[model samples]
Target: MKTHIVFGESGGSSLRLALKDHQTNENIVVVVDDLMWGPIGNILLETVQEERIKWWEQVLNEEDKSDSIAYLRNTYKRLSDWTIALTGNESFLFWVGDSPTEYTGLMFLLANIPKSIPVSIIMVFPAYYKRYGRFKPLSAGEIIPEKSSILLKMQNPFLHGLEKDT
Candidate 1:
């Protein structure tokens, strides 16, 4: 069966809600990480883990440090396992938004995803240009699978560079 994986910030709850609302036939996997504004190093396994631990330590309170660390480790483990399982599967979609964190996640996926697996990326624009001339930035929680059709389609970053060809 095809699987639809949604990568975003906010601990995956919003994506899961959105996917549940959309009622898709495909199995869904949500990878949530708020990497938008943080210190990120090379995407190597060790570097990524060290950077994440450092970042979490700085952001989380001393009392919550242990719990937060455990959560981060578990989340990363789940994401890694899911990525591995999805390889060679013909059907998969990566739903990402236009943000530093989301973009980083996209790059990571592109680097690791199997070349044989055809992955479609739906890039959600940060803001909507209203007809009345107001630009409204969308909240990360606002994106839902039901509204995915309106999102921009970009060439797979693995095959094509991150630049948008005009």
Candidate 2:
């Protein structure tokens, strides 16, 4: 009955928090499993409900780094469909990589998602990270203010919620 998916480089934080909140309110149940990134994965596992955990175990079995990412994409594709079927109405609030230009799979799926399904897509503004040689998270709006650029071209599906700093 709940539809929420979060992806990205630290982009999953908002989605994870929303899931936790929903669980607390007894409105929904969450299964938490994440692609290994860093400390965030550990924190998420500890915080998410045990019953909702659906981890991509194949990633662990793969020796190649690219294979792991591929497994993640395939896993989500399968899970997304299952989640939609299990719940009658389908709604997805996914926060993927701050920039779709960098994350090809996320961009492809978002664009190619069936329009007939009445799916709601929200792409969170990217927050710069230190690992990318930046000391802090930077907004795509700030980095590339030009509206002509592809980065700023996509309209946020859930603009109202984003206005409040979700």
Candidate 3:
């Protein structure tokens, strides 16, 4: 099955639904951190990760944001372990939107994902018109459920002929 790595829970939920609609039984992994605005020093290191979490906590507290940043700990570990355990039979598709957080997540995965596994990316861009209000998607998660199956049609070049029917 294809392991889809997407940013945040909303994206994960939406993608999950889309995959179901297309009769695809792919797995969805969500990385909840908004890595766009925080410390990047030794980000993969355990200590540095703790420090980064602290920084996020401080920022949230200062801004009176009620959401807790503690989820980062589990999410980081889960993502790390998942990627490291990937086998050659599995494939991946990273959904990227025109946003810093999405780019950051994409870069992180690209840097660590093993070369043995087939990898692909889905780039989401905004389409807009000034003359009249037209339909546009800000992110992959924002895609309407009924139309989301279109994203699944994207081909993974690395697995064009290697795909197995499971």
Candidate 4:
């Protein structure tokens, strides 16, 4: 089975709809917390996890879910477990956009998962944006859900000694 890992919830949701349209049984894992903004050290450790939760609650200006939801608080732990539980038969297709959050999430996934597991990435970007003779970066949310099927054909190799499952 191939699991699709995405950074934000919107990106994950869009990719899920795309996968449904493409008629695939791929599972989606949405990393809600923005790793780019938070202090990431040892997420598996309970003490660090508490510090991050407190950071989110007190530092970030958002409604606190640490005290309200049990499952939500252990987001990193769940991701870590998911990564550890991946079998040799399972593959990963990371839907990465041009965002720091995606980059961090991808790094986390790469670090945790075994090197034997095959990997692929869908790099989303704006088609028409031109900035200083360079294409502007885009997030997965910017990708058209209808074009996901076609985009699958354009998946790029996440090369770092990683290759797609043959």
Best by TM-score: 3
- lDDT, model 1, position 131: 18
The clash numbers for all candidates, in the given order, read: 0, 4, 0, 0
Residue pairs clashing in model 3 are none
Please provide TM-scores, in order, for all candidate models, with all chains considered together: 0.62, 0.38, 0.75, 0.73
Note each model's CA RMSD in angstroms.
5.0, 12.6, 5.8, 4.8
Off by over 4 Å in 3: 41-48, 62-67, 126-133, 159-166
Which prediction has more favorable TM-score, 2 or 3?
A: 3
lDDT of 1 by residue, 44-106 (tens): 364686687788889889888988788777767776666556546455566665566667776
Predicted candidate 4 versus true structure: per-residue lDDT over 1-166, tens digit per residue = 8787777777777888988987888778877767676677645455766776767776644454544345547666776677567677876788787877788877766765667777877766633232122544467776656765567767765444444222
Q: Taking the tens digit of each residue's C-alpha lDDT, what string does model 2 give over 1-166?
A: 3354444333334434444544432122122233232222222222321222334333355465456555545544555555455543444444344443324433433444443333334343332342133433222223322221232124345423233233
How good is model 2 by TM-score? Answer: 0.38
Rate residue 106 of model 3 by lDDT.
79
Each prediction's whole-model lDDT (CA) = 0.56, 0.36, 0.68, 0.67
Off by over 4 Å in 1: 9-11, 35-51, 58-60, 126-140, 144-166
Check candidate 2 and list the clashing pairs: 31-52, 31-53, 128-137, 128-138
**For residue 166, what is the lDDT in candidate 1?**
21
